[model samples]
Target: MELTCFKAYDIRGELGTELNTDIAYRIGRAFATFLKPKKVVVGWDVRETSPELKDAFAQGVLDFGADVIDLGLCGTEEVYFGTKFLNADGGCMVTASHNPINYNGMKMVRDEAKPISRDTGLADIRKMAETETYSEKAATPGTLTQLDNRAAYVEHLMGYIEFETLKPMKIVVNAGNGAAGPSLDAIEAALKEKGAPIEFIKINHEPDGTFPNGIPNPLLHEQQPVTGKAVKEYGADLGVAWDGDFDRCFLWDEDANFIEGYYIVGLLAEAFLVKQPGAKIVYDPRLTWNTQEIVEANGGEAIQSVSGHAFIKEKMRAEDAVYGGEMSAHHYFKDFAYADSGMIPWLLVVDLLSRKQTTLKTLVEQRMAMYPSPGEINSKVADADEAMARVYDAYKGDAIAEDRVDGLSLEFADWRFNLRKSNTEPVIRLNVETRGDKDLMDEKTQDLLALIRQ
Candidate 1:
């Protein structure tokens, strides 16, 4: 019963300690027994331990007589896509994502790429993995094969854009020495093969698990300047960077300004609405004014969901939403099995630019001006519960409205803020936004931080 790596949504733990090859083999056996999947697709990121761990998991699956399709070093979403694309029974991605290099994890999916979170059988899997009471291996061990899913995966991504009409655009892609490099290269090569009007300026484009440059997380304030500088240096039309697994991508405008993922939600909502009016667009509760405005203005329904990929995907399926986005840079598409993709968003943005004959700056400048946001800011605290309560008490009186959809969100006449505790870490994330008032956004953010720290 010693299981330290299992989590609410996926499996994550430090290498050689909480997770090792033996545990991985047991997890694979547990998954095969639990899901009884006829075919399982497995992939791993570019972490040092990933290959050995992935092989162990594959062996476990084979022991249970489930066929295994080994997807070599790739992004997490590729596992999601491959599950459905190949009509496999289930899939797993060995990746720590943007976590520190010492850490590693797994993301699993069921038939049709439906996620397998703790609530949806991960808990039982965890127990089986802990107890090692898996059913006896099949009389005939399952078959194993290797697959190159990149070409098909690239084609699937390019399907989202109309290439013939695309205008020439210079894009800077910083892979941050993660698994994103190969996929981007494939897509760029395919685009060139078709003679599409696009230019790629790649930086830190190699996939090195050592992370020679740094971890590929663009969300960090310190990491923002890297892509910004690359954009300015290349004079690129836009800049994009992916996390360790490339499941999430961060962006920068032509002016080297880092655009908050919240605004990208609005920008994308607007783009999808133009094509499929009246479609439902799902967004998180962290920051809502801009998303709500854009969705409503574009004649689409704006549905709010709790954050995290599992929650958003669940909501997207339930509502049949066309698109769902979290301000944290995870974007889900209906056509994409309601799974998030770091690649799809940038492609969609490029299409929007070509269709509108304008810059990313223009597309988002108005929305940003209409409702300025300070973005999500995280603060470490001794007790997150106490901090949340104190902030609620201080602002509840002046608030015109409030909701606890995902967290404590207080709305005033001119500005609103949401304070939510991190599910994975002991920190409270605060986001402040106002109606065209940068000063108000600035003042309220600092004020809330002071109160939280107090």
Candidate 2:
């Protein structure tokens, strides 16, 4: 067993190599033993190898005399929904998220959609796998029941937005041939039923295990071109895309301009606060100023957290936060069991546009101009710590203030920069932003890159 597969948030590795039935069985057994829950729910994506892995994993769970509910061919978010809907003790999702076709992994959640992080049980699972603690088989195998909730999931999301209050808008939706197509199909009809003025131009709506259109990761620059082209080709008001498992979502405004997830965080915070004033809004530490301003302006409390869904969800539950957003495109909601929902954010935002009678660009343009961002820049360096240390040393004393919440964050009077090492990759992610000072942000970004290169 490769202990490295146990990541900060979930277990992931190359499919046939580091991840296989043997590994899956161990993980299942570990999960069942550790959770010791009465019933465990299981879900998987459309990946070709997901079925076999799911079966093997469930078998491990049953060996421990824990019943398993198999939620077939669903997105990871659905697994979250199932955990809460069925009142299960815990759940595991068989997915590698946006990883390449040759990779797969598992994401586990505690009862009521709580996350299982390294601090919780991920490390124990790794240790159990390594130690080969095979428990004695029970007298009877736990039963497995196939279940479907995609329709109910869609219906639940619809309850958040008012279709009769929406205006007809042209929007381009790029599923990237992931698992979002079915959900989007349901949403479109639901919107039409309420007489919404909305038209969807969809691309790569078909789910294909081969990922012929490319991996469903919308973060990569190469993947943006497809959605960007669609936005321009159709002359649409906006474009929305999702990752492989549809856990995170991305947006593009009119004229094919990519909207920063940070800005959307503030926008959604403000929108959600209008209905739930005094509610706490959760945001990652990487992008703080804008989210703080938005929440404070709306009379809502702002809670800063480290990046990743597990950390955000845990904080959201603790703070009883009404909403949470990460610069990485993950958004969480209180209504959805405090779990992140890739579907609801877009739906609510679109509904906001309709209720306000504005375009998506119009809704976000002012905020974008107020806080120009350098966008997240990924640098592949020999040593991430060395690169981050060099960058930090250069700016530490010079900056007005510094923070080590998630990584190294330096705040100047009018600008700021965050340099953090990736949890899963040998790289450093650098994000710089300025208070309406694009030239200064650009110049400082280059200077930091030069320092890292040195």
Over 4 Å off in model 1, which ranges?
none
lDDT per model vs. reference: 0.92, 0.87
Tell me the lDDT of candidate 2.
Answer: 0.87
lDDT of 1: 0.92
lDDT of 1 by residue, 45-158 (tens): 999999999999999999999999998999988998999999999999999988898999899899989999989999999899999989898999999999998898888898
Clashes of each: 0, 2
Q: How would you encode candidate 2's per-residue C-alpha lDDT over 131-233 as one tens digit per residue?
A: 7775666788799999877777877898888777777678899888888888788889877776777899989999888999888998888888899899999
Question: Can you list the residue pairs that collide in candidate 1?
Answer: none
